[model samples]
Target chain A: MKRIKKLDTPPRFISWCAVGGYEEKNGPLGEAFDLCDESDTFGQKTWEMSEGEMGRCALNLALSKCSLSHETLELLVAGDLQNQCVASSVGLDSFGAPFLGIYGACSTCTEALLILSSMIESGAVTTGACVTTSHNSAAERQFRTPLEYGGQRSPSAQWTSTAAGSFVLTSDEELIKNAKLSNVAISDFMIGRIVDGATADGSNMGAAMSFAAAESIIEYFKESELKPRDFDYIVTGDLGKVGTSILRAILEERLPSAAGKHLDCGNLLYDAKRQDVHAGASGCGTSASVLASYFLPRLEEGEIRDILFLSTGALMSPSSVLQGNTIKGIAPVIHIHSSAD
Target chain B: MDIYTNEGKKEIIKKFTPKTKVLKNTLLAFIFGGLISLGAELLREAYIYFGMSEKDALTLVGVTLILLASLLTALGLFDRIARYAGAGTLVPITGFSNSVTSQALDAKSEGLILGVGAKIFTVAGPVILYGIASGVLYGIIYFIYLYIIR
Candidate 1:
């Protein structure tokens, strides 16, 4: 099966927005986020409910950014790092659109983008949005331990970000002909193959997911004949410090140019040392919030030309990790570029 | 070099993966765990100084440690200290108390019976099982020695 596909009719990014909790609001790109709740609760009683609210707020803000109403959206592709994707389903249920729920663990954001872009390019769904979110407290309870549990984290363990991101895309003929575009679009994308790096330690997810990121980048490079220097940056989802180092070493001999252009959302989302995030940040929100607030804006404003955004995910449940199964990883790459020309 | 195979990628990951500071973690764990033990000893001595019997004092000290650990866990302070303390809080009665309390706190959102009751032992269940199993095995050996050999 072909892993890479170049969109003949790329979908235009109309509007985007990001919502984050207190920790994320205090991060480097804090000011860039569209909305933030200092309480991290979003006025909800439960962490799960708070995570759901983030998705709701992200989608609402994305639509309102361009003064678009709810009726303007025909489809909504959304996901979250919750069991059965409850965060997306329950959170986005109020939108009352034709919704398609997806799960790619932390890579849900890019996966949703890839799917939404494909639907638009197919001309089946001309106007749609993709939303994804993750909460640290919720993820900790489900995937690792209780939020209040006293346990020492490994140096490689990444702190989960409490955040959400949403993007609105369209391939409507009338909108395109009228020059109503956000100046950023999905040009091409490559769906990643699941790869296991043989690291069973759950705390060190970067090791578990690094192989998938390397493979996705390598295959995309081979298929498109595009070197790493072709893009301004090769942004990875949340491989954090450990995954980034391993990815660099792997790409050093193969895709040599990639090492210099590589950037991980995990490292970029937070001040690791100041925040006491051992390795860096993880979760679907880590990449989604970064892409929505940082990359998409820069692309829209034409500050950067293009980026190969790879949202990587470690597909491991608490049961799988406990059963001694190796964590599988996947990263779907989307070639997002400025369409200013 | 071979990114596809597990063994090939493992070698690459090992090269780039940062090594955990074993010496530092060990020292910290040792010092912290010792501190907890010392605190327990001091509590027991204080109880005895107040005219409590030695046995009663020891039991009271154990209860105090569990209570303090539970309160700290609820106040969300134990985990912060445990982050730096490593196994310091984990190897003592406090760690056991924390395991149970943390699970209970997490499950409380689900409900009373199914959430807190059933899931409370999620983390500490194994310890309880193995601890009792070893005790039973030792009791059997002691019984055999006392009746047959002695």
Candidate 2:
């Protein structure tokens, strides 16, 4: 097949558990549209979900286990991985904390991290909550193939993990404050701008999304601002193996400054290590799982510190690239404080 | 209501002659169309009194009604009927059978393999499915009373 890579991410959270039950996504395009037309948000009505309505769904579940509320926080800055950034657009519902929306691709979580830390030190908000998620079937159905086409998947691709991931950005007081997080006073950090990353044909998403992972991470610490050794984990969303090695080499050469601190959610998920995926992770939920499931647990346990989390995204849209076009991409890097010990 | 003399009358006569929707099939359609339909309608009433199922009664009466239509179709009665009482000859069951069989006859010159052989089955697909479904449901009821009860 011709290498035609395109992506459109819907509002994403870190869990598969959130969307599947809302509607049974089945069938080909005409019928699926027919069913969803009467069903989920991707179903019947509007595309953008209010932050309180959606945020509370993900946060309320995580916070129920964490014991947090809206009053004790610093800032609630969230953005959707979807168009108009509506997925994370309405992040200002209940917590009353100042919120912001930024587009950095499926790499949105990292962008959200950059803002939370900025607010923490600038005295804007002591605590901050960062959230991002991508619905697999919803995102995929809207963007790529029909759900039932379960055709042969290329080794160059990674299975989009079904999960929603969220994190509490807070000071030392409470990790989750009223579902809003206190600022994690980062001892050392810098906001990294995307300069140069992978230029591989994203036709194989695993490769393309990973190229983004590699280039962004290398450009980040090299240009301004921080040492690679300053942080423990540098995670990228679903870069599987194809792009991970690509990311590793580019970083080791340019920013030999932080080679060992790299961690990629793409390659680490499952099949990314064995050159199994022709490309790497592509969806918003790809990193959503690792941030919420893998990284946050490690953060709470003090196993990692000075965390530098970045979700890599391929901003190639179907319309622009379909008619033979490519667009520039952006990745945001956030340096966070995990634990006091 | 308005009056017209020689020249105008000629144009009016030509217009009326071309557009007349006259049902002029005095034999194939008019007489048989009347008699067969009347017979089916009468038999339909008589059979219902004698306990004929609506489904079978519709089918039986339909065969007679469409027999009239197929004869009319064969004798070129339909082209004239197409002009008058527009769809009367088109509605009955025999009309559907007449459509397929007559088209087959018309295209028979194309050879049996391509025309007649292929034509009867052209309208077969949907009929096959509905036939199978109706037969299965009826068969199940027939079996329950005869085989199961025994």
Candidate 3:
């Protein structure tokens, strides 16, 4: 069966919002974020609770941006880096909508959107929401170490983003008119297969996840019969500096022309040298927040026409990493275009 | 597709991954670690000057170092120094204190019993287990040497 699916009458992303923490608020595209908490706490006593609050706030902002209520939300697809996806489930539980919790790790944003768009296209859901979040402290405690742990981070290690992103997608043109900004639509998507590059290092996640990104891009190019120049940019989720170069090299071998059009969410989120983020940023929020705040707005304003947004994720747990198992990478691409198309 | 294989990807990643500054890190670690040792020695000397025995002074110095490390970890300053210090902070007793204190602080949210009490030793557990185990093993070997070989 084909992994690429073209949505019939693409569902328009009517509203979206991005919420960020201290580091993210001071990032390069800091001002682009809709909401930010300087303390990174969001008034929550615990980091885990803070992460969940971010998801809740993001979804609320998204709904409010479109002037839509939770009742209108026919379906919700959400996930986060938390174990069993607790952040999204507990955070968004108050919405009381038909909810589906997914686990795509960092690829959650695109995966949620991909699933939501398919539901809308099938007329199974008229309105849906896609939300994902990640907090640096929470993720570090779960994946690597405690916040106060004094450990040297490798040069290839990436800082997890403490941010959240939410999007409201709808098939009804009437509701689309009520959206704060409505133009971009989900046109097509390709679900990536699990790929292991045999990288066992947890600190250097970009290396482990780059192969899956290459697979998605190469496969998309082959199936779509499109060149790099056809789209404004090809965005990858949290590949960082290391993974970006690796991806470019892999693309150069087969599709040399496609190498230069790449932009990694990890690279875009932080000023690596200035921020002292050795490699770059990674997490569900890294790509989700960037896309919600930066790319989608650009698409909506007609600044860019067509772009392929690829959300890449490394599918590995702490247990798996500790067991000397190789990290498995998965990336799913979403074809989002300006309504001008 | 063949080009995207694990072996091919590894070759590509090796070319792109940036090199770590081992020499620079080592130099920093050396300076920092040496400075920490010097401070401890001075503290031990100061304690001895106060009419304390050498053994008592040494014990007091150990307690002082542990208190300083724990305080820094609690104040959230140890990790910052440790970042650039590399193994400098880790090789010393300060590292062990920081590990235990940090773990305790992290799990403090889950409550004192199951949280801090249980998880306080998670990071330092291996070091402790192996340290004692190896010491016991060495003792057994020494006993055999004393009774038989000697």
Whichever of 1 and 3 has more TM-score, that candidate is 3
The digit string of per-residue lDDT tens for model 1 on B1-150 reads 777788887787777777888898889999999998999999998999999999999999999999999999999999999988878889899999999999999999899999999999999999999999999999999999999999
lDDT string for model 2 (B1-150, tens) is 011133432232223222222345323346544654677789799778889898888777877665666676667555445433333444445446555555555445447888568754444335657879999999999999998888
A1-341, model 1: which lDDT tens digit per residue? Answer: 67778898889888888899888999999999999998999989899999999899999988887767788789999998889999888799888999999999889989999999888878788889999999999999888988888888888899999999998888876755554446998999988888885877889898789889998998898888677898999999999999998898888888889888999999999998789898899999999999988998888778898999999999998888889998999999999989665
Each candidate's clash count: 0, 44, 0
- Ordered by TM-score, highest first, the candidates read 3, 1, 2
Instruction: lDDT winner between 1 and 2, please give it.
Output: 1
- Model 3, B53: alpha-carbon shift in Å? 0.8
Residue pairs with backbone atoms closer than 3 Å in model 3 (clashes)? none
Residue A103 accuracy (lDDT) in model 3: 94
TM-score of 2: 0.51
- lDDT of predicted model 1: 0.90
Provide the RMSD of all predictions against the true structure, rounded to 1 decimal.
Answer: 1.6, 25.6, 1.3
Candidate with the greatest lDDT versus the true structure:
3
| Deviation in Å, model 1, residue A255 alpha carbon | 1.4
Compared with the true structure, what per-residue lDDT tens digits does model 3 show for residues A83-186?
Answer: 98999888999999999999998899999999999899889999999999999999999999888988899899999999999999998978877666778899
